[model samples]
Target chain A: MSNANAALAQAQSGAVQRYGFTLGCALLGLFLFTGCQSGGQTSDDKAAPVYEEGQSLTMEGTLIDTRCYPLNKDVNRGLDHERPEGFVKACATACANQGFPVAILRGGETDGEVWVLMTVPAVLADYMAEEIRVQGTVRSTGVLIPERVETFSDGEWLTVL
Target chain B: MKTIFSLMLAAFLFVGFTSEKTNQVTVKGKLIDTKCYGMMHDNHTNDHMVKKGDKMMKMPSCATACAGMGIPVGVLEDSKPGNDVHVVIAPAGTFAEHMDKEVRITGEAPYAGSIMPGKVEVKNDKGKWVEVEVAGMM
Candidate 1:
């Protein structure tokens, strides 16, 4: 045992059988990759947790306008019952002849800042692509008109989040 | 310098031993040109069931790439567990070099915005990779 200690005891038993065959092939390749990736992943790769129990949404607050000026439901809430002293110049001339823009998104604490209108592409007036998540439900519309805006019960200026 | 430091370590080991394959979307043909599950019905959601047309494409990750690749899968009905179809296997080679010919798969399209398009890889108009067999609908 003197040939450089028999080549350091055969390189320490060939590094313990190559580290026990690379730790038994990395624990049998991590148990065949978690039994073949639990039915091929998806749904956050099998973490699967998105319980949307029958709609039920209305968390927290902020969505108001009982006379707050931070609502821009695309302006104009100044109808003229035969103008009495030209109220605010007849709501700024019916918000510049019905192209209004002041603020609207009825029933939701409005003091400032909060947007939830997710999708609205019917009959168009701009509003598509919504899903701000965290308990969803958004419906508030107010449009002034002569052809379609009967306080929009179904005129659909798009706004049905 | 030592041959410009061994030619910059052989161009950094030839860009780290080259291995980056992209351009793999294979679909040649046959899995019964896909269209299964109540095969078309519901023009405006009138509902008779069996819904989904325009070439069905979706299924448990295409049945895990067609399990043991004897490749030929298209289901909207059978193998019920949670009905949501789309599966087109036989890509990325080795099912006997994609069995009976014609392959053109190009890759990169994992249901972009999800109207339902989990995977689609087929090519062959000189784009190569023409070995398809995934039709249960588009």
Candidate 2:
């Protein structure tokens, strides 16, 4: 064979080889990029624990009638209300039975934070003015989605509802 | 070309982040008693009927009474079965009087199936939306 023809063939072979290498690298890079995208999506699906919001919390407080409590914290924070004769006094249990928002007045202080209990009020009416502990998630500020509720009675914590 | 591509990518990322951070939702529906609705479903009406000792007795839905009693109120977007009932996080009796009435609530949905209402408006008799003052809302 002629040297020019042989050199020309060698050059063409080297170009084809380089083109193949470039194509192969591009394909590999594409596969890796797609794999990373899918992997990232899966990780996002199995999201990390959310600590800032939807945090599980346990709070101890006193059961109060949310309706009347806001009207008069001192007068309505307890089970009973003071009223003149012939005028029926409003009580926490009555308000609860009437389906008023029942809340846990933290520490039983009139000035304490009120966490509205997201539960059946009639079920909780019996425990009004009683010390209780609620375990659940805080959906928002002062709103508790109770998982379990226990009332302090007779020197012990009893699961009431 | 590279700069333009980078700018477009950055803008998309910004939009994604902003949307992810937006958790506020507004829902308009009829308020119903959560317990009775759970027990009665579509059968839930302004009142309910129960068999008391072999005698079927009709009774009021008592939704307002239940709300005053501390039962969480549920809002049904429609009567369609399998539809979600959004629980309103507000003073128990706040929505009591508006039970079975159409209401529009705006609030943050911190979790699924719940709304921490910031504004609650009920549709009046004249078809006007009236905002009800939510008591004890922190």
Best by lDDT: 2
lDDT per model vs. reference: 0.29, 0.70
- Mind giving the per-residue lDDT tens digits that candidate 1 earns over B36-92? 121331211111233258544334333223222322222222223233222222221
> Per-residue error at B131 for model 2, in Å?
0.9
DockQ of 2: 0.17
In the range A58-153, model 1's lDDT, one tens digit per residue, is 332222211212222233222221223322433333322222111223233322223221211121122111111223422211211111111222
lDDT of 2 at B121: 87
For residue A94, model 2's alpha carbon misses the true position, in angstroms, by 14
Residue-wise C-alpha lDDT for candidate 2, range A135-161, written one tens digit per residue:
977644565668899998788989987
Q: Which regions in candidate 2 have their CA more than 4 angstroms from the true location?
A: A1-118, A122-159, B2-7, B10-20, B51-56, B79-81
Per-candidate count of clashing residue pairs (backbone under 3 Å): 48, 13
Reference-based lDDT, residue B122, model 2: 91
Error of model 1, residue B60, in angstroms: 39
